[model samples]
Structure formats: structure tokens, C-alpha cells
Target: MARTYSLNTEAAKEANNGGKRINETGKYSGKIIAAFYEKNQKGTESVNIMFVSESGQECGPLNLYTHNSSGEELAGYKMLNALMACAKVQGLTWQDTPIDLYDYDEQKVVTKTKECAVELQGKRIGLVLQQEEYQKNNGDIGQRMVIAAPFEADTELMAVEILSRISQPQALGNYMAFIAKNPVRRLKNSQASQPAPRQAENPDPYDDDIPF
Candidate 1:
């Protein structure tokens, strides 16, 4: 499909120093919405808003950076935002009115997430939200993050696109399982590497059976 938002050659050149990535090529000056998904060691998932594009091309996959504290990646959000920004810039709106979420199955397990609907030159189209983020802030306290992604789309074309671009379920599951198993080994290794505790310098003072 033809993209509504065309990458600004000049801006992209400046941004990438002449080498532009695929997703960046579609991003232009517009509001780029992005969502992030974070999976902790215990398989708990969190979503968070990663960015709202101000100018220039989208960050592409490279935009997904791993935060030092949480070690979560944000690339998917970058790409989605870029695509949406491009669609808006192109003056496209959905004709069929795509649903906000669509159901999909991975290995017979169904899932869903937010989706984007747009019409380009009278052609109805939709982009599945592969990921999203919901941000939260507490009073003089701290900020929290949540992340989610669409696992399905309404059309076969969109579904194919998503499948080709996103990671497969089985692969992701195996990887997560692998990570969960390694922590135990790591804990054991860490404990084994530490020095034993020093013995008490003085014996129990309460001992009364001393040989005279």
C-alpha cells in the first residue's frame, strides 16, 4: 500500500546522517503516537506511552531503546507512532470505520489490542496497534508505566503485515520461559561466589559447664 506520509528527504538525511531506516522513511512532521510493552522477570506485563512526535522522521526500530533501570525496549512504539503521524499528514481517514480492537489467535490463543483506521484517497485501511503505553503519575510521588500490543487485525492484509513485522508467539513465549528459568541459576551462582560469614569472635557467654 502507498503510504500517506512521505519521509522528508532533507529532514531524514539530517536525522540519520544520510542513511534512513524503513520506518523513518514514512515519518514526517506530525503527532506520532507510540506505545510500549514491558515484561518483567515474573512474566508480568506493563504498558507505557513512549513518545509523541514533534518533528522530523520517526525513530523507527532504533527508537526502541532499552531503559537502564527497567531494561524494557521501546522500538515498537516508535514505529507505530511514525506510521500514524504519516497517515495524519497524508489526510487519510477510515471509511469502513475500523474497530478499536480486533481479535487474533496465536497457536489457538486469542488476543487483541488497539487499532488505527484511516481512508486514503477513498480506500479504507487500518493499522493494528502492535503496541501502546498508558502513563500514570502519583502526587509528588512517582510515575508508572504500562505497555500493550495488538495481536490481531480485521483484514487479512493487515494481519499478514503484522505477522511479518512482529515476533511470533511461540518464539516470544520460549524466550520468556528461558529468562524465568535462568534467574534461579544466577541466584545460586551469586550465593556460591560470596564469602562465608565470619565466625563469632566470642563464644556464648551463657556456657556454665566449664571444666575446672
Candidate 2:
């Protein structure tokens, strides 16, 4: 049976935005599960081959007409190719097993995905997969897979350490530091940046004597 795909407005928006970012260097790791093709419906042209995320979470039906490039239209297949390449590099294979999509809501999936992304990001020192975008593709692909690590500093260092334990270490300390500094700044900025006050809180006078 074909998998059902569903997404609320937010997921659809994010997926659509991610799809628009695909470029020649294959910098965009997000996949397009569906494509648009011309079909006659009620004597008018209509969309065909709508891609959907396997989990049916935030993703909505993706129309193919939105894609501007033939290569971009092949996003799903390209992501699969990248995943297979990564597996091969790590001496892994998918001969008899089926691939499973990572569920962002699940703790195990979250940990595994973060770990993989962090390692690759650390090694590369200059790439970051839009994580929500990655999640959408994860659902679309419906398989256990991996990608090159993201370039976010903390993720980079974590990834480097993990990969090093399994293989050889490289000099990414500078890159890691560069990535780390900005996040720290952002954290501080976020703390300092507060929204303006709204109405004052209403105190519950009747509960003043309640037990702690």
C-alpha cells in the first residue's frame, strides 16, 4: 500500500522553503518526495505525483510544478544517493534491509540524527542542514540513512569527537571554535532580547493560604 502523507500548514511551509534552496553543489539535502506533472482533470491541467512525508506529520502534499530545475525535482533520489554513499564510506550496506525514516518526536531518532549530523558538520566545518528540512526528508525517504555532518559549532565538535573515536582525528579545533563562538553569542543575545510586557498577571487572592 502507498504511504499516507499529511502535514499541517507549518510543516508544509518549512518543506516548501527548504525545497527552494536546492543548488548545483547539492548543498540542499532536503528531498522532494512529490513532483508536478501535467494531467487532464475536468478538461483542465492538474498537478501529478505529489510527494509526501511518510510520517504524515507536518508535511503537506508537495506539487512538482514549483521546482525550477530538473535536478531539483530529483531531490528525493539525490538524498537517497547521498545516504548510500555515506553508508558505503563507513563500511555499511543496505543489501537486504529496508530503510526507515527517523521520527523527530522519538528520543532515539532525535539522538541518532543529531549525532550523525554533528559528526559530519564537524568534519566538513562549513555545512549545516536546515534541521527541520532534514526531518521532512527523513519522513519522505522512510529509511534509516545518514548524511554529511552539519557545520553548527557545537554539533561540529561533537561530531568530530564521535567520528574520531571510530576513525582518525583531524585538525578541526579552529573550525569547531569558530562554530562554537556564535552560538554562545546567540545564547546571550536571546537572553537579553525580551518581548515587551503585556497585561499584568492577575493574582489569585483566594489561594493565598493554600498549602505549598
Q: What is the C-alpha RMSD, rounded to one decimal, of candidate 1?
A: 24.5
Cα lDDT of model 1 overall? 0.29
The local lDDT score (0 to 100) that residue 41 gets in candidate 1 is 72
Q: Report the C-alpha lDDT of model 1 over 1-212, residue by residue, as the tens digit.
A: 98699778677555654332222112112232333344457544333222323333223211233343444544443333333322322222323322222134344423334222232222222222122122224423221211111112222222223333432433323323443333211222334222222211222212342111
Residue 17 of model 1, lDDT score: 45
Best by lDDT: 1
The runs of at least 3 residues in candidate 1 whose Cα sits more than 4 Å from the true structure, single-residue gaps closed, are 1-145, 153-168, 175-212
lDDT of 2 by residue, 126-167 (tens): 222211112234444121112222222223222323322323
TM-score of 2: 0.20
Candidate 2 has an lDDT of: 0.27
Output the worst ten-in-a-row residue range by lDDT, candidate 1. 143-152
Name the top TM-score candidate: 2
How many residue pairs collide in each prediction?
Answer: 15, 16
Candidate 1 clash total? 15
